[model samples]
Target: MIADGLNSKVFLAPMAGITDKPMRKLVHSFGAGNIVSEMVAINALSRRNAKTYRIADVRDEPYPVTVQLVGSEPKLFAESAKLVAELGAYSIDINMGCPVKKIVANKSGAYLMTEPKLAADIIKAVKQSIKLPVSVKFRKGWDHKSVNAVEFAKICQDSGADYLTIHGRTKSDMYSGNADWDIIAAVKQAVRIPVVGNGDIDSVYKAKEMIEYTKVDGVMIGRAALGRPWLIAQTHNYLENGLEPEETSITLIKQTMLEHISQLQKYYGEKMALALSRKYVCWYCKNLRNARKFREIYVKINNTEQAIAEIERFFAENGSDIDERS
Candidate 1:
C-alpha cells in the first residue's frame, strides 16, 4: 500500500542494462503500474543528449512512471530532475545503490554513502529544483563494517527526499548473501518518510514478511522478476486482497514470451531484440522440466525467426512440465 495510491507496491528496479522501455512496457502489461525506467546518466540528461533523452522518455510509457538518474554533481543532478519532470515522470528516484565497479570508481552510486554531505547535497538540490516527488535508493553502507544506512536515511529525509529505498546489503555484499532486512527495519525506525525494502524478496511470502517485519511502505524486486513480470501483479493482489495469482502455465508462458519478443522487435528491432532476449529466454525456461536441454538450445538462438522456432519447439517438447531452478 504505497501512499501514492499507485496500482501496486511491487516496483521494477531501475536496472542499468535490463529495464529498457520495451521491458518496462512488458511489465506494465502484466499489471505493473509503477515501472521505473532504466537509470540514466544525470550528466548526460542535463545536457539533453539524444541517447539520454530516449532512456528518460515517458511518452507512451505507462502511468506514474518513476525515472531514476545517477550522478555525483549536485547541479547536474538538479538539472536532470527538471528534465525528467518535463519528460512527464511522476517521480524522480536518485541512484545511490548501484554497486558496479565503474559507477563506484567514478565516485557515484554507493560511493555517495561514504560522503553523506554530498549525498544530502544532491538530494537537496533535486528536491529544491523540481516540483515532482523525489526518492533516493541507497545501500546499508559502503560495506558491513561501515553500515550507516540509518544516518543516511535521516540525511535523505532532512534533504527533502519524499521517500527512501534501502537495498539491505552493503556495496561490498554486491548481491551476494541475504539482504539484511534488520538494517531495513532499523532505517524505517529512523525515518518518517516511506522506506522501501529491497533485497532477497523472491516470493510473495518474503514480500509479506518484509512489509510486516520492516514495516516498509514498499518492496522493490531486481533479478527475481526477470521472466516473471507477472509477479508484480501477483504481489499486489496478495498484499491487497490476500489472494495468489494463478500459476502461470506453459501455454501462457509461451504467449508472454512471444509478446515480449514482439515488443522488443518493435522497440529495439528484430536483430537486437533477438540477441537481447537470450537472457530472458534462459530465465523463462530455468524452472521448467528438461530446462537444461531447452536452455542449451535457447541460448544459441541468433535470430527472430530462429527464436520463434525455438519457442514453439521447446513448448511442444516440455509443455505442462514444471520444476525448480532459479
Candidate 2:
C-alpha cells in the first residue's frame, strides 16, 4: 500500500527528460510530498540498457520516490516492477496518461484507455509482482467520444492499483484546453482508492480549487513547475494554512537557479551539464526583463563557467522585476 504519511499533498509529476535528479532534488528541497522519475520503458529496461537504467535511477532522491514505467506488455511490466523494487523504489506508477504520438502508437500511454482489459492486466501483474504500492496515471479517455476514466479507475482499483491519477484532458485534447475537474470529481466518487487530479494546475489558488472541486486526495504539478520549483512548497503551504504565500525575492530566485545549475554540473559533469542547462536556463529566465536577449546569450554558452557568469550578470542587471508567476 502507498504510505499515508506523506508530508504534503503537492506532488511533482513525472515529466520526461525534465524531472531528472537535479530537478527532483530542487523540488524536494522545497517540500514536495513525492517525486516521480521520468517514464522508463519496460522493453529497454529488460534489456539492461545503460541509459534507461540511468533514467530509472532514484538512489539520491528523498523517500517515497516513485518510478514510472511505460509499456504495453503485462509480463514486461511485472519484470520491470520487480527491478524497480530491487532498486529501492517506494512506489510504482504505470504511465497510461502520456499523449506522445510514438508512445500512443505503441499501445502505451493514453492508448490504454481504449484497451481497458490490457490496462487492468498490466496493473494486476505489477501489483502481484511486488510489495510496493502500485498506482496508475491516465487521461480522461482516448478522445471526446470515449470518455471512460471512471470505469478505468474502477478497473484499476479492482485490479489492485493502490491509487489513481487522472489528467482531465483526453488523448485527442493533448493539453490544448482547460482540464475538466468535474470529470476528475466523478472518478473520485466512483473509486475507493485515492485519486490525484492533474492538468493546468499552475498556481496556489488553482491547486486549492482543484482539491476542493474534485475532492481529490492530492494534486500533481507538471509543466508549471519548469521555471518554479518552489511552486509545490507554495501550494502545500497554502493548502495547509490558508495564508498568502510570502513573496520570493529576486535574489533568492537567482540563487536557486544558480544552485540548480550547480547541482546539474556536479551530477552530469560540465560539458553534459552545459547542454542540459540551456533549456532550464531558458525556463528560469522566462519571466525576467530582457529575457529574449538573456536567452540568446545563455543558450549559446559553451561552458559551465560562461553559463554561470551570464546567469549572474543577467540576474544582477534584471533583478528589480521578478516574475510574479512564482
User: Candidates' lDDT values, in order?
Assistant: 0.85, 0.87
Considering summed lDDT, which 10 consecutive residues are worst modelled in model 1? 1-10
lDDT (tens digit, per residue) of candidate 1 on 213-319: 99998898888888887777778778878987686778777888888888889987888888888887777776788878877887787777887997898888778
lDDT of 2 by residue, 127-225 (tens): 899988888999999899999999999999999988889999999999899999999999999999888899999888999999998899899999988
Model 1: residues with Cα > 4 Å off, grouped in runs: 1-7, 324-326
For model 2, the stretches where C-alpha displacement exceeds 4 angstroms are 1-7, 321-323
Please give the lDDT score at residue 153 for candidate 2. 95
- Give candidate 1's error at residue 227 in angstroms: 0.9
Best by TM-score: 2
Question: In candidate 1, residue 19 scores what lDDT?
Answer: 85
Backbone clash tally (model 1) = 0
Which candidate comes out best when scored by lDDT?
Answer: 2
